[model samples]
Target: MRRETDRTMDFLDEYRLRPDPADPRLSVAVTGVNEAGEPVETRVTVERALTLFLNSREIVTMMTIGDHPEYLALGYLLNQNMLRPETPVTGIDYDDDLGVVVVRTEAETDFEEKLRKRTQTSGCAQGTIFGDLMDVIENARLPATPLRTSWLYALTHKINQTPSLYLESGAIHGCVLAREDRPLVYMEDVGRHNAVDKIAGYMQHHAIDPADKIFYTTGRLTSEMVIKTVRMGIPVLVSRSGFTAWGVELARKAGLTLIGRARGKRFVALAGAGRLIFDQDLAYVPDEGARHRRKGARAAEDAE
Candidate 1:
């Protein structure tokens, strides 16, 4: 996440939920030379820094594209263990001019000690840790939800087709919360962690039950991403990107169904293989269409 430090309010006012090349707010025009040495001016993704403060103390700063700052802040603190699971978040106030957000809780809390045990995670651009939450994944009892091949194919197609910063600027990642093949919420940010955090925050704020929703991301399946999804209590995690070895091991250990390299007509389920229903036959089903193949796509049978 590239934090510009000051583009929060101004850029957000012009940012649209649907991806648009014309939205100058999400991107900026820059002049550069192309591979052929020709002059080119194109839009690049915008980055901004947002500081999070829990109660009266400053927590941490996050680099983002400026959309959904409030949700990102809440999700960051919650996942960091700075905020208690049952703690009542009284209010979240964002100050655009200052590029800061303050989260108010019902209880007067302090995590001065926990804040020191930070672990730098491989969450892409943004990285931080406030406590030892590495083992929480093993404690989650995910619901035994079945994911059909039909649902998987449809979900990938729709997600790839949806307008997003990834299509608009290339240097972006997105995360979606969905039920079956239907997408319930779509979010994009400079870093994969930011996108995932935004989704988690939205779920927490809205009180959306994660018992049945599937978590999807355009980012790679890493240990950090897996842990966050599991912490949200989501059973199924899908990614269009490849998987990290540690990510796979952790998912298998936690019993979380992790699917990766998911594209048209093909997907590899590494964890929670029991939930998959092979309703679609490979003999009849067509390969992933070129148009819908997103970034980080791999050969269909390469791993699964």
Candidate 2:
């Protein structure tokens, strides 16, 4: 346990970007009563509205934790099909006082019609997808990257141990962009979709190759999550939560390796099982410590 804890600390130190649970702006202290009517003081996630603009056109307003506004703006546009990968970005402007962000691109864009056709997703804080996003992944082919069980175990251990808003406050979601066992960027938000978009924007801005990366989330594997992962060209998507039927179907269709219910030594792969390599010996793996178990893991334990 001590060796694993040391390795987890080392992995966190190597992260290019990770959540700061100590940030005062991300969460606030609240006084509440427990089930036994005992007074308790705890932190709660803060949500703010961020208005996004594509050049001169106002795109949409989102409720976010407000850490990476520029990334959220760019990613939301890209995932919504308003911004293409090949499109050149001139600049991204953010006015924190006004709670607004504008993304300037070299080529002009008009999405007035696409905005009229929007699909509400099953993500927290209400996720919206514009236009026909399904068409974007019809011909998508993800790289057949192999994922080792050892790497999976290492990643889950490190991620769960790393301090974040979700661990500090109970009502937030998190997403991580990782390569093998190393987590690169860890983002947290009130909504799972926003967390994913932030990671997408980071990749686009940093020019990180997604073909060799994996995406991990602290939310259910829904269709929206599967779609966004496929659109990002990532081959592997993992979660500590369970899966939705449509999410599994989409993963199979896109050939994305979808692994969920990943707590401790246990995990379920409903799609793209061909890429998983069972290289770890189960005897050496330890069950997730009760203190470190997230809400999903706890709920699953209750059901069992």
The numbered model that scores best in lDDT is 2
lDDT tens string, model 2, 54-159? 8888888899989889988888888888888778899999999999999998796657778998998897867887888687568788999999999999999888
The global C-alpha lDDT for each of the candidates, from Candidate 1 onward, is 0.79, 0.86
Clashing pairs in 1: 3-48, 3-49, 4-48
How many clashes in each candidate?
3, 0
Per-residue lDDT tens digits for candidate 1, residues 1-304, read: 1222222312233233434546677888889999999999877899888998988898878888887888898888777777766788889999988999999987866578888788888887647766776767657777888998877887777777676767766788888887787777788888999888888787787677788879999889998888888888898999988899989988888778999988766679999998899786767555776655653354434545
Query: What overall lDDT, based on C-alpha atoms, would model 1 receive against the true structure?
Result: 0.79
Clashing residue pairs in candidate 2 (N, C-alpha, C atoms within 3 angstroms):
none
